[model samples]
Target: MEESLPEALSTERIDGYVDLRSYGAIGDGRTVALIALDGAIDWMPVPSLGSIPVFARLLDGEDGGAIELAPSDPFTVTRRYLPGSNVLETTFTTATGRARITDALVTGVAGRLPWLELARRVDGLEGSVHFRWRVAPGTRFARSSPWVEQTTHGKVIRIDGVTIAVKGSDHGPRGGGPRGLQGSFTTSAESRHLLIVAGTADEPLHLPDAASTDRTIDRTIQNWQLWSSEFSYDGPWADAVQRSALALKLLIYSPTGSIAAAATTSLPESMSGGKNWDYRYAWVRDLAYTVNALIRFGLREETHAAVSWLLTTIKEHGPELHIFYTLDGDTPPEVELLDAPGWRGVGPVAIGNPAKSQLQLGIYGDLFVTMRRYVEAGNLLDAETGRLLASVADRASDAWRQRDSGMWELEELRHYTSSKMGCWMALDSAVALCELGQIPGNSERWKSERDAIRDWIEKHCWSEKRQAWVAWPGAEELDASVLLHAPSGFDRGKRMSTTIDALREELGRGPLLYRYTGAEREEGTFVACAFWMASALACVGRQEEATELLDGLVALGNDVGLYSEMMDADDHSFLGNLPQGLSHLALITAAITIEELSR
Candidate 1:
């Protein structure tokens, strides 16, 4: 039997936001939630990752809602993911006793569940530990008002068409009108208690009993371990590489097999705000890196799924590829600014991204590189996919001459050097694939255009004064993105090697590097750019320097081995979204490159 808690334990929120570093994630493949070190689940989107968040306390504070569970006394905390799994085990030590909490967005006996379920299991390790818990669903970012309704089944919070039910241990307020379900219980030594939160949108909710939910949580842990065991990579930094692979897996949308760039949106790239943009969509560039990393680790299922998803999505909407696509493999909606106060009052919490309509020439290389890698991995492209790639190559050849937004997706269009290299890579891949009889294309035209792109870059992109290939012709700014082509085989000569030093001297902050010359003024250093530098150094025969830089960068991740889209140079705090796919993908690729080069 459980006893009542004496008082409440509050999770301190500085200006209504928890530090990004203090959060760990749990997902069921369809959606992910961020839980703070204090045991408050502050962010979770229901129905899907791109769907409206049922808990947005991360963005809107207490008004946005959260599911909070913590010890009722002053306590210290320590936590880690279970070995080879995403299941989080957090231990809380109070003055009188110690208790442990195991959390997960559960999976099913077969695979992912038909409905969403978040399970939290509590065990008392020693003495008596009282705990306070609350299940509060938010206003969907102030878009809807939710209230408790008593149905024949039980008590549930309803907002719009979504129904959320909290089950298991009961105490505190009998009916949580609008404030949501709340309770308290004390755990004695050797005691176990379970709490399960289940939800469904426009469908009947699946309320699994405490026994089944507990069993499912265990099964989810085993499933994650089983998935982790399938991949083999005994390279340097193997632990960090494995952790990054698992983080990337959380961002993969299970239904469509497309991966989101990050699990959260509008987390900000700068504390002062305005740089916040939604990243819950899939980008061709990010997917390419993910595919390469997965391929290198010998993980075939996700690699094939991601490749198939990209080609199929492009085929349906292509001839001209958008920079990104929604998780459902469609164009993203127009950006919508929400009414909620952003994280730490960084306003303009947003949904959808505007970059979808931008003309990013880099996508040509991204698509072709993905196809080439997939084919090289003993995978076959269907007839239609091969035809589709040929058309993409032709489009790349013609579009190469046009001034457009480069990989950075800037509004001021220019002939960014990275864009030219991307076109060069695309055409080169197309010619190679044609020679391999993998795709139907005009080899002569592709080769001619490919050489022209190289000539154009050689003549215009290189800046002797800066001793680097500048961001664009007539501009003296350095861009870290140019480092990518070193690994792409576009350049690994003296020019590329000199450019690496130029970038480090100009853009490096400790081990982290900004994306471009002025990026430090507007945002934190881009996390993926730092990893790219490591890979570029390795590719350019500076493996020793590359390994050293990689070691420092690897130490930058939070305790849980997760990285954000960017990191502040001054404080080393995370900026932008959590568990950034590109950052993790870049880490995986860099480790693989260094491993391959060492041999």
Candidate 2:
């Protein structure tokens, strides 16, 4: 075994920033961890989504917490997920030896675990390798440090009522117990070691026997493989679709069936302030997209559960629904500007989203889309939910005339073409559901309202100057959101084809597409918009071009096929929250469209 540090390993600062793309992720339904290529768990929210992060180095860098395991000597790292699972395998190759590290946030025996468990396994591939690891939890986003104590299991760290126990490898003689959990151990070929971090706050920490814990990891892998086998899409990009489906599954909070928008908070959408927002909570629009994608993948259980949860929430807060809610259907707390230097020194790292109060007007349509799919999947709508649907449709008919924030949640209120179309879609889907006798509603009024809304968009939303459906009425600037209309059935003719061409001319960055015309220069290309463009291209009969675009967009995903909310235009680095639900949903939708076109 090598004892000396190689040049790169010696020089590589454990606290330095790694490209977001250089990370893979593992989750256990409740939360996810961002595992860098060098074997560091940088960002993770334990106990639940929206909870205080225990390892937030992705945001606070040196001051944020991290759990890192890597070879003592310098090494070149390559990583991937275990096939069809979120278990990440990062392999390190040095001049002397090679080793592979597998990371997974494993579920317990009953399917969904009661506690958060991170299982890390190391296997010696060649020669002999010396690996060092430490559990140095940073101050909780610089707010406070966790109190650490030595326990029989190993080390117990407590932060905000959450208890995390760090257990060293059982395969080797343990060096450090609870204090710091740092040490180096050597492994030869055919040798293996398992390290576990189990967390709990509400209940007593469950430190299962070493053998049982190891079995739990194996069972978690088998569970994921089983779920992946159920995916029905064997399409143009089957692997990407399967990966996206798995990513979406990670975003689902099993207890309540709410799907979060993404896995992290305070990850910047752009390089700096105001663009940084928390995405740990579930947005109705993103959830709708998730439900649609889940249904498409033949995941009816999850789709039905999510839709049922969302409908119950909406019914509880009827007439006026916010854009998003907590996983338990509660209003999110006020936005807090954490006193932490954000990623790349971007300040004003916000916790809660202020977009909650903004009138996005799109929620009406988003919910209806889910409801439509729910019914189409042979799920019945109870009378209460049916009445609630009618109420939402009526509100959409009345509220479409008001000035509110558009889909982007911009501060300025305007008649956003996309929002108008969203209201139209709300009525459109409501009418269809009513006509199908799935819901009780005045179909005549809904039909008339949607017809009028269509006429309004055709008259005001269309831009003669650009000869496309602009972002807002009479505005020359275009948005990638307009591409959504193709799948929503807003436009499917030559006009849509021309609109696609116009958008590509205006906002396209090769295969990646920006959210709007100026977004490429300001922020990165949106992962969702690129897929929407691909779907639009397919809808407009450009099957070959659409497939090409879809392939390029699929290539942008990280090595394990995970996507973030946005992508850096120049370097293609992942930006914002990871395992973004909308992005994965769009990818699945694009694959489905391509497959249908091929058929």
Candidate 3:
């Protein structure tokens, strides 16, 4: 996350093309950054999580930009999170000695003002350690050429075209040397070096320097601890779950309380080109899962604020619904491919998302289910919100039959059976709302329509030969999306069990599950799908099996507790986008459901 992602490095471009690999994630909510195991900072979107990238080297190499901090000697590395927090501590033991570098994103703790900071403080714990670091800033998506200037403290890499000043750490006086002043600091007992690479976009933020790089390192720590103080979570994996939850918080854009789909976007779901999508926007489904997980952790404030943001976004944008929107509730994003070499030679590093234009009918399910959960919790949905929900349900019924881009966002259109169920779920919730006296809707009508939709899905979507729901009306390929039946309340009886078993037999890749078969073009384990399996298992009374599977998925997180969109099943390398929102959301949902069921 933000911890490993230096504000300056080519990893930013690398992230854009593929993913920030196995390592760590650190964030202060407004912006999330991805850090890799090789000590690379692959991504950072300054000002806010959804803003244009100031550092996007995950997609490109030197051209894309990044901040790098690595041991100066040959070293073996190990890492862990701070006992009670998500702060990452990595120890490298080289010929010179060993040093522990702690990475944290400054948050509003006690006395600190609001600002985003990535702090990598190196402390020599054993022998002597020498480290080399650099702050390299790229153009907007590395498209803008910037001049590097020798500053009073190290160097200041700037993007004049975009006017972004990526400041470096306090190493020494400027213009020391090309290697940037290297000295072996001896540590028989104690020695320390703190490097801070802060990325800021005042034009986009309008925050003063005092607030931009505000020093509340202690305050940020205290704030996170204090907020986490109320968490009632405790179990064998309590520490792991808590750290995951904290990482989720870091991905949320604080101002709007909206969660981006992942820390880094355009990280190809596929290693090859053409699969990349910008995840810088908020998905109703992903955010809903985030709220569910945080609420389970006793973090009511985040749940409430996030749901409020969702409801507010829906209310503000009437009738026409979008699958994803910006943190501030903008329409379908602007799509463009920045000129840059792709990650590992994967070409066409793109920005914005084409899925924005596609009609993803599944969003209604997310909206209704999330809202209904809030209502079920006895939280009040304001009058305006209730009316908004009713209207959305009404409009959704008409659009249910239309061919959408489908959940996969594939170009070819068909009656995607999974999406049809989503509409049914919306009506189901609409009926629930009618019963609860929350809105004025025809409960009987909604129920009848919901039943009809269910019948059509069963008739056309399920395969007799496969014994599972196919991807669409006529397709023979088994879709992992169909596994959602039990979790979405579509068909949890023998039908769902049949589908789940078939999926396990076919799509279960190694320890985790994949979205579909023969889609190496779509390589990577669906982190969310794996959690969905766990949820379906729990609901189907396979409690023991579900718990075990969930345990395995949690272990997939990197050493410092970060998950990418996919895992390199062969080598177990974390692949796809780093610190994916869907992955965390899955973690949150699976944990909460498991905990609740155990209760």
Model 3 has an lDDT value of 0.70
TM-score of each: 0.97, 0.95, 0.89
lDDT string for model 3 (1-599, tens) is: 22332222222223334334444777776777666665666677766777666666766665666666777677766676665565667777788788877777775434323555677777778877777776555666544565655655434545643333333233433342432222233333367666665555544321223333335454565667776787887764676678777777777777887888877666666666677767778888788777767766777877888898887787677567778888887775578887766667666676788877788888888788888777777787777777788888878878888998777787878788888988898899888987998877567777877888988887898889988888887777777776666777787687788788888888887567888766655577777788888878887778898899888887667656667787765655666666777877777667767776776
Segments of candidate 3 deviating more than 4 angstroms: 1-20, 109-115, 149-155, 161-171, 174-188, 203-215
Worst 10 residues of 3 by lDDT: 5-14
Q: Pick by lDDT: which candidate is best?
A: 1
Per-residue lDDT of model 1, residues 7-42, tens digit only: 221346786687888788989999998988899999
lDDT of 3 at 439: 74
Ranking by lDDT: 1, 2, 3
Evaluate all candidate structures by whole-model CA lDDT and list the values in order: 0.88, 0.81, 0.70
Candidate 2, 460-576: lDDT as tens digits: 988777878988887889988988889898898887888888998988778888887677666778889989999998888889999888888887776678899898777777788
The lDDT of model 2 is 0.81
Under the 3 Å rule for N, CA and C atoms, how many clashes does model 1 have? Answer: 1
Winner on lDDT between 2 and 3 is 2
Clashes of each: 1, 1, 42
Question: By TM-score, how accurate is candidate 3?
Answer: 0.89
